[model samples]
Target: MHDAGDAVSLLRDGVVLLGFGLVFVLLFRRLGLGATLGYLVAGAVVGPHVLGLVGDAESKIGVAELGITLLLFIVGLELNPSRLWRMKQEIFGLGLLQVVLCGIAISAVVLFATHSSVAAALALGLPLALSSTAQVLPMLQSAGRMRTPFGERAFSILLFQDLSIVPLITIVAVMSRNPADANGPPGWLLFIYTVLAVGGLIVAGRFILRPLFRIIGNMGEREMFVFAGLFTVIASAAIMEALGLSTALGAFVAGVMLADSPYRHELEADVEPFRSILLGLFFLAIGMMLDLHAIAERPLFVAGMALALIATKALIIFGIGMAFRMPWRGALALGLLLSQGGEFGFVLFAQAQNALLIKPEAASLFGAIITLSMATTPFLMTITRRIRAQPVDSSDREGPVADGANALIVGYGRFGQTVAQMLIAQGIPVTLIDTDIEMIDVASGFGAKVYYGDGTRLDLLRQAGAAEAELIMFCTDGDQLSAELIDGVHESFPKAAIFVRAFDRRSLLKLKDAHVDGVVREVMESAVKMARLAMKSIGIDDSEINRSEEHYRARDKERLKAQYETGDLRAARDRIITQDARPDTGLGGGGK
Candidate 1:
């Protein structure tokens, strides 16, 4: 407890965490488990109860709290209201349905099993209604479901859960009956505090933070922008606390208001390093706090509680998914996805313990249960993989009628639009096949010849005259699927020339692997166009133009390869630009 001893204890804690984190990272890589799961496991190992290295586990919870705030800020940056409003039915109706139904069902089960009061049951159930956005979204993106119907449904539910935590906290605070003066404030007062805190933060973010960010953006200083983002988080959290509301709510509100701000993406990119480290520390603190001894001592009781918790929550989520007419497999997937208690559970559980909604022993039991359930979710997902492996059965539309079209555009994305427009201007009859309804709708409004169907769907492609078209363009983005389409088009229509769009170098390699007639890197094409314009501005002429372009492309590809290999993009960019600008360098004999 002495000053020197405290310093040594802190150093030991850091050492414990460093060792634990590295081991978990290696294990996670081998297991193909995500880094977040690895972080949690690392926290558990080095936590106070396991090794006593963290020493007084509760102390670091504050830093973990800040990490959650930063996470919410980043999440807020992802949600733009105009875009959100476009999915109002899903966000409002289905989202609210998922939260309320899940909460009520789980609360009822808990009440019956524990003989707890309705209010106490509600307090426990509210947290279970939330799914882990951090854990789920990245996986969904990796699965290529970010824009899919199922992904949108999952996203809406997660967003609602985040918003609902505010009300849940207030309700628990008001309903608890224990200590004489436990009636901290009136419900109306809490409501007032919540509204003022949220509204004021939004106003500040818009009028103040937005302008400040614009000024900092003009400075073009990455470090300064990072500092400004941190300032926003801390300031919002402080304001929320001052107003007797949750700091998480304030941070989220700040994020939502800045969702459409010009510099939102820039702020996110700059703030990432800080957010990442803080979040890692947070997970480490969580691990260090775990009382594994307690879990072992009451193994049967804790195991029973954890099982009951997951079962109750899963059943509720599954039933809701079914009622929404989600396929059986999708329902099972949804059930498993939300079986664990999320981050908000910690907040509410702590509050409930303080408010005497349950005894300290019960709170400890709940905490252990939450941790166990979370730890098991990844394995549960793996077990249900077979159920999710079934192919989606969307009804196929007859592709564009085999017509007088000589050229065919297979995708209607940014690259496809440019290609289609230019072809149309040149009086080429181009038929478009795209699966996106929104894109098809927009194209229809502009009187563009577009088919509303998946290009990769063989029937649709054949019906669209793939066998007869003079030219076939595989401008779609998926890797294997796009390659399949190219192969199918080539096999079915041997005479048609194939032009494909490559998403990245790997995709370019895949296209080359498939031996597509011509492949263009969609993003690099834009960069090359800009480079050509710059070269022209500098009085570069026809004799040197092709050589200069080729040199830039080769240098750019090398730089990208180096960046990917080393995970140090800034250094690679610097090397590329420095090498390119040198006059002594030969651009393959083009006046270098």
Candidate 2:
């Protein structure tokens, strides 16, 4: 789709790539590795240097790079402006330290190891300082640690690394030995241009995006929203590309502007599929670009530099984490988690090659180093599990895991909001999921985070961390809870207590066979409370009021049990006064 293909060649490439990606991903996942590595291995096997099944990795990468932009946009949605500002210390302090120290140290290593000039070393080394955001984020999410203190810190560092790409590119350009490169804008001018571009994006997002979403949401067309979502991301990225800036950053800034939008989840859901496919393709292209012949010629040099890059970055980052007061275990884990060479290394290396600061052979060699280093991450992190598996204790010897969002609330309407707030007030971590984009927008305006999805689905719940959640509360506004759904959820996540908001006595009776901890009628208690208040307002004595309230509750309970037992509507029909009241429809009050 990146460009028009006239022959069967395009179809052939698609079949080959997707087919191979699917098989390898399944195989690797079954083997306890990861999809990223599988994609890489698949691409390598099919690349020109290997089976020669695919060529033109460069054009593929040009199209696939949109994946990186989309990735950053999603990452941006994870943090609102306030949260991002709060983490300024970590992003700027710890992150800046990590990139600069790792860059300098790796450059020195390259200079000594390769006997390269300072320019060549810097061109190669700085890119190695960056870690793979695409690789690390999913691992953290799958582990249910993406919202933890540790996860936030990791996210902050990655964010800064992304922002640093502009400067790294500028640095490479400044050191260019090619006469052609001399005509490009100088470093300072580029910096000013970057600032102007970012400012322009911020202004546009503030003035343009919300209104556009408002219109799209008003249209109430989900398909239209999908189109709008992609348009937003692509348009922002395109502007950055026009300015020769980080297209990913432009998408990110746009995301931050809408972080608190009620449509955040909808946008995320719409964009995620594209992000995954493109990101996979991006990895595949990186694999195809790897010059195995170049690496095969100097395997020792490539392997040694890979090891050295990982070690230097890991140690430097570990020290920096400790300086930021992270415990040794957390620090060590963080270091290893981010030690891999990033996708941007290829971009920067290409820049280096273009500038004549490094030869094409050098670029290919370092690209292999990055790929090799990336391959080691899953293994290293898998090993770090033992160090972090233990729950933190009073002694503080263990690195604490991400433990927030232990409760998943399935609605955010009026009823669901009260339930969530009460639980949150009690210090329970709650994840709010809703399907109503309008309601989500209102909640977001009040600074509440609500994800968009059909929470009844087991797969969606699992993605939201229902496996570890202590409670699964169904506060949806109707008889949306079914016995089968409840039973499925209970079976799927046995550890979590299940609760549902019953629409009426009939609904409660329907759930008698379901595995649930509790069920409450939507308006039963509030109706009773209103009755008590009405009695008091009419000057009824306290004892009489209490007696009347208890009698009504007792009779209602008795009727409910009788109807549930007999499975007949008439079972409790005679229990209620029929003089003035209409028939009970066995439905909720239809409250918003």
Candidate 3:
């Protein structure tokens, strides 16, 4: 039923979009830049302003909007009520200050530079206040910092920004409304309507969605569950749109409603592909909308504005981190990680333009600035990391005096703390070494004799009396670092019995290769304990369970030793299974 020209246009758009998108992504990835930036460049290259290969930017915008909706939905899914409650300080305090301060600062700058009205400056500044969650979060995860103090704080602030979108969108809509319409409904009446609409949606979600999903899930068709989830989002978005509320806000509420459901992860898995593709399309559309001609005309001015915005955001974030008593290094890292403008800026600018809050030209210019800021994020974070890694003054390195302690502990984290506590309970004098100064200071407050230094440093280890210590234990969460430490210590202090806390089987093997005196897998003992419980629950006698556990442990140790010596885990595992399957031996029967 579609026109032949329209069909041709669709085909051409898909081919160009995918073709350019793939090449740019590969190239950007190779350069250590992210895929989001790659997609943006692809869109710009194929857009009418450049090659004129794709002129359907207007048509693509609707599809791109779906991406934002799904993104908000996923954000909602992540933010269960309990998590928000737990992170209230960072979300409300740090997040609020970041937005308000950044907004005011950027607004003043815009007003001074462009001589724009207060409302226009504010419209520009508020969206610029946000940092890119989609970009920064993945970068943090890849760097293995998500469990660190800095990462937790960063996540909390980003979460608050995502939640703020609901009110921000509402404010923009109210501002965009005509004065003539304002005369029709009193402000109090509108407030009541908004409250009632939100309450009604929550109620519907609690009652209607749970039962609907249960039924769909019972049917056991994965596609049906996906369909139902999409239906819920679209339907809720429609209702909110009709009620003069933000569709994203509505979709978010729907996601939270199902957050406690058993199918939450399933729903997330089902919707992820759609969310990712749509979000990419959204970024691509923004890319297509870039006014490259404007940039060419005033390159210095545009670049200056972008740099100014990043500087403002970084300063404000650093100030907030300092106010919260974070170390200077941590504050600097936080500032650098979140200096970029967010994906939400695109959404806000589009909405603002639609609401007549900003002109098309202003929107175009701001969009370009945000895109550039986002593209610079990876480099900024890398620089911050390098700065953080620089060696500190030796005078700052204070630690517990070795004092001839027989045992030296490296990495006073959760695992190390437990081991240290048990040793201390028996009146054992211990020297603990950790690189995290903050963590060491806190542990010191709890009467722990913790040292602040990189445990892997040979001089630091020597200072901690590693050469004289009877036992040296590596209890850090970092598997590679633990293996490296074991290797170094074994080479330098062969008399010290090195016992390592391996994170998994792979780490255990690595530690074994390092010729450590003992390698205790972090999870193996707990797994064995649980297996004992499982056996008892199935009517096995306690004595039998104990015998079985002992037999299994001995056999596993023998197998591990054989695998280490032969460097053939697969063959060792096959031989063990073959021995266990035989009926004659008591140990083999118990093993099976």
Worst 10 residues of 2 by lDDT: 583-592
Candidate 3 lDDT over residue span 1-592, tens digit each? 5798888879888888889988998898787677788888899999988998888787798987888888888888887778888888988999999888987898898888779877777778888988888788888888877876788999988988888888778767677745544554565766776778778878998888888888888889899999998998888788877766678988888787877778889989999999988888887888898878877777776788899999999999999999999888788888888898888988898888777778877887888888789878788876667676635555766754658988888889888999988988998778898887667666868877677777777777787888888888888885765556667778898878888888876676666657678777888888889989998898888878887777777777788888778766654673353543742336324443
Better of 1 and 2 by lDDT: 2
User: Between the candidate structures 1 and 2, which one is better when assessed by TM-score?
Assistant: 1
Give model 1's TM-score versus the native structure.
0.75
lDDT of 3: 0.81
The C-alpha stretches of model 3 lying farther than 4 A from their native spots are: 1-12, 26-32, 177-192, 214-222, 259-266, 384-396, 421-427, 445-447, 456-459, 476-495, 501-515, 521-592
Over 157-235, each residue of candidate 1 has an lDDT whose tens digit, in order, gives: 8887877876777677787675632645666887887887777787787789888988888888888887888888888
Q: Which regions of candidate 2 are displaced past 4 Å?
A: 1-5, 177-181, 243-249, 260-263, 382-592
lDDT of 1 at 334: 76
Q: In model 1, which runs have C-alpha deviations exceeding 4 angstroms? A: 1-5, 29-33, 75-79, 176-183, 193-224, 256-260, 297-315, 318-332, 375-524, 536-547, 550-592
Model 3 Cα displacement at 175 (Å)?
A: 3.3
Residue pairs in collision within model 1: 43-287, 44-287, 47-288, 48-288
lDDT of each: 0.74, 0.83, 0.81
Top candidate on lDDT is 2
Model 2 scores a TM of 0.64
